[model samples]
Target: MNPASPLDNVRIVLSHTSHPGNIGATARAMKTMGLSRLYLVNPKSFPDSEADARASNARDILESACVCTSLEEAMGDTFLAAALTARSRDLSHPTRNARQAAGELIRYAHHHPVALLFGRESAGLTSAEISHCQLTVQIPANSAYSSLNLAAAVQIMAYELRMVLEEGVVADEPDPQLPEPASLQEIEGLHHHLEQVMVQSGFLDPTQPKRLMRRMRRLFARTRLEKEEVNILRGLLTAVNPHKPT
Candidate 1:
């Protein structure tokens, strides 16, 4: 029997997708790559005939897709989120080529939830949306006309992930003594706790907040903090502000 695929823990998140056909085609693309988890965030049209028709034999993926009201909801438990975009932004997160990002995600998904986040068809993810992602992945395309169909982009990413699994390019199993990496929710909680302490301690001013917190978020995003590490950090934050609980 074949070994289980790490793709099982990697979810495809379509954010505010405008076209139902693309949504269906994305599901088909993911299914072809042996990826079944699909999360839709505020899709314009779903459960529509066009999507069902496009999905074809992969209709099961569409039927089981998790629909959420927001990206945060879709990424609730995901430990890593890689945003797909071609545009450059003023404030960007750590970036990697599609292949590199896919390999990293495959390794992480071996034992935890990770996500590939794609934006709408007309325009890619907003800077605010991109900020939430820990990494950005850009596909190399013709510079003159770099635009790709939403489904095509999904296919490319899914293909890379499938290749990683088929080629057995994954991180070795952990030693089991170390705590598991913290989940996205846990990390977000840590951020919240830290921010509260920072504000209370006068380290960060809420009124004219510079990119301080954003930079901190980026710094922590790349840390891949373990559960124990997060606990230790939270403990430090509590120590800093003993009068007020974080």
Candidate 2:
């Protein structure tokens, strides 16, 4: 049997959303990021034509969305819940940047369900609603004018969640078919060979080497030269000065 996707364990909750179109757009955003679980807490409008029109290809997400009467009901069975808010309150949970908070949420979602809660469009989450979350995430934006539309906020959070999950998976599952990178020994050989050619060619001064080799090493490191690339570079260096030991 196919293992369940980590995304299945994530729920995007919108509380007291005013516009049905924003819900539809949010669904589209979530669907683009491979998130399908959606919960609406006392939305002003659902099953509205504007929502259906905006959902477009992501109508499935909206069609299956769970509508609840309250935020508590929407957060049911979630092991971790993060509230997205721009406001600062005395009693609110300590806030984290979106990416940092998403990483924590991704880790929790590995073992249990997690929820990302967003508040109303006009006035974000109430203090009472914010208290229900274990963490509060604030998207870093220009503080002078940092108000984001309901759908835009949802898109940013959904994108962050998808990125964290995808990044973790990529780290854990390297492609077996891809060639291994050039080893330190091979890279060193290439560097030494290039230095010999450069010295012979008079482009580099071996007598007074000042950060030249170090800069070259940094350049190669940035390239992440593959084994084949190193071999090609060695051949090119040999061509430059065949008399020098390659």
Candidate 3:
């Protein structure tokens, strides 16, 4: 059997999309760029006639889309996720232009599943939602009217990725012998374990987190943690709190 295409490991994730037509248009856009994986997180509507109609000749993309209840769920198996947002957030992840991010994303996708995350049409990704991502990608547009339609944003990103792939543009490749990158789910587990230890140790007050964990997340997100590294950190946390359950 042929090896899976790197694009196959790159999924387009739409979260809390309020409009069905945008979802269909997004599928159509992805299809045009040779992207097939689509993940919908808590969409307002799906399997709707409007969406089907908007999908045009790309109904198969919509039909195969994965529906998720949460952004975390949508990104569970992904090793890297880039949040597409025009708005600035406090302590946001490292920012990259669309073209720059596409190169990096494609490089990572060659090793593991990666995601390009888009938020709702009316409002972009929530701060908490963006926190789940490792990088933030912005499509350069007129500052006076930076807002882009949901499908349009997806199309822009998909086009950039397609161009990167076609042009053979990729970021500095990591050593192939390095350990695999940790999945989002695994990283989340490490976060949870660290938070539990922090709360128990009085380092982080649950009542007033005051962005403590958020900062930690930002720090770790920059690390591009590996699977073994995550396990080692979790082990350290456990060692620090031996009484706590594993």
Candidate 4:
């Protein structure tokens, strides 16, 4: 792996993971694929003996893993995040197979930080959790018995990403003249600002808020907003409602 490989900018995020052993196994899996960044969101257990034992030689990855209270915090700095899900969703982001998504993620990972999200061992990622991500990825499997272990899923995705890197296949370099992509934190802030303006302007009724914001999120998710674009939109929102803070 190159010292400054794009994999360095890609993080593997496991949310609400229940098994410490799986966490350890995931660390081992990530290390094998040259992916070192690991973020744990509301995991059931960590820094435990079981996890340490499972990690084996990859204990260093476990030691350096980041633990966060929420998925938002775990991916705040990431420019793009893709959720791994087996089930279909009503208003989901664009769906892709593991290999295709790996290629797309690697493209963005070259210019900015990106993340891959995995959910709980049993239920997988919630709709709300999936909504937080900009893209959804599914691993093709036998329809009859497609269930996969948490660590197994991570390993599959990691391997695909590694393949993309090793093959020297990546998107063209980003134009330096354009502004950087918007980080998750900035996008969330824009969402909040937009909502505030909508509420104050009586455009979004707070009493019966339904899928309006969810649709808005989906719309923006498709756009892959840049930092400057986000700022411009927020500025417009502020203009619409001067009393509201940007």
Between the candidate structures 1 and 4, which one is better when assessed by TM-score? 4
Candidate 4, which segments miss by more than 4 Å at Cα? Answer: 171-179, 242-246
Each candidate structure's TM-score, on Cα atoms with residue i matched to residue i, is 0.91, 0.67, 0.94, 0.94
> Residue 48 of model 2: what lDDT?
93
Q: After superposition, how far is residue 142 of candidate 2 from its true place, in Å?
A: 0.8
Q: Of the candidates shown, which would achieve the greatest lDDT relative to the real structure?
A: 4
lDDT per residue for candidate 1 within 1-246, as digits (tens), equals 035668888899999999999999998999988899999999998888899998989999999999999888999698889999896666677889889999989878877889999998888898767767788999989999999999999999999988877777675584566568888788888888988888888888988654787787778877777888999999888888855645
Cα lDDT computed for each candidate against the true fold: 0.86, 0.79, 0.89, 0.90
Sort the candidates on lDDT, descending order: 4, 3, 1, 2
In candidate 3 the C-alpha lDDT for residue 108 amounts to: 86
Q: What TM-score would candidate 1 get against the native?
A: 0.91
> What's model 4's lDDT at 43?
91
**Per-residue accuracy of model 3 over 86-161 as CA lDDT, tens digit each:** 9667898999999999988988887789999998787888888888999999999999999899999999999998
Q: For model 4, how does the per-residue alpha-carbon lDDT over 1-246 read when each residue is reduced to its tens digit?
A: 887888999999999999999999999999999999999998998888998998889999999999999988899999999999996689888899999999999988887889999999999998888878899999998899889999999999999999997787774576677668899999999999988888888899998765888888888999999999999999898788957555
Clash number by candidate, in order = 0, 0, 0, 0
lDDT of 2 by residue, 108-185 (tens): 565567889999899998866765566688999998999998889888888888888667643434356655455445
Better of 1 and 2 by lDDT: 1
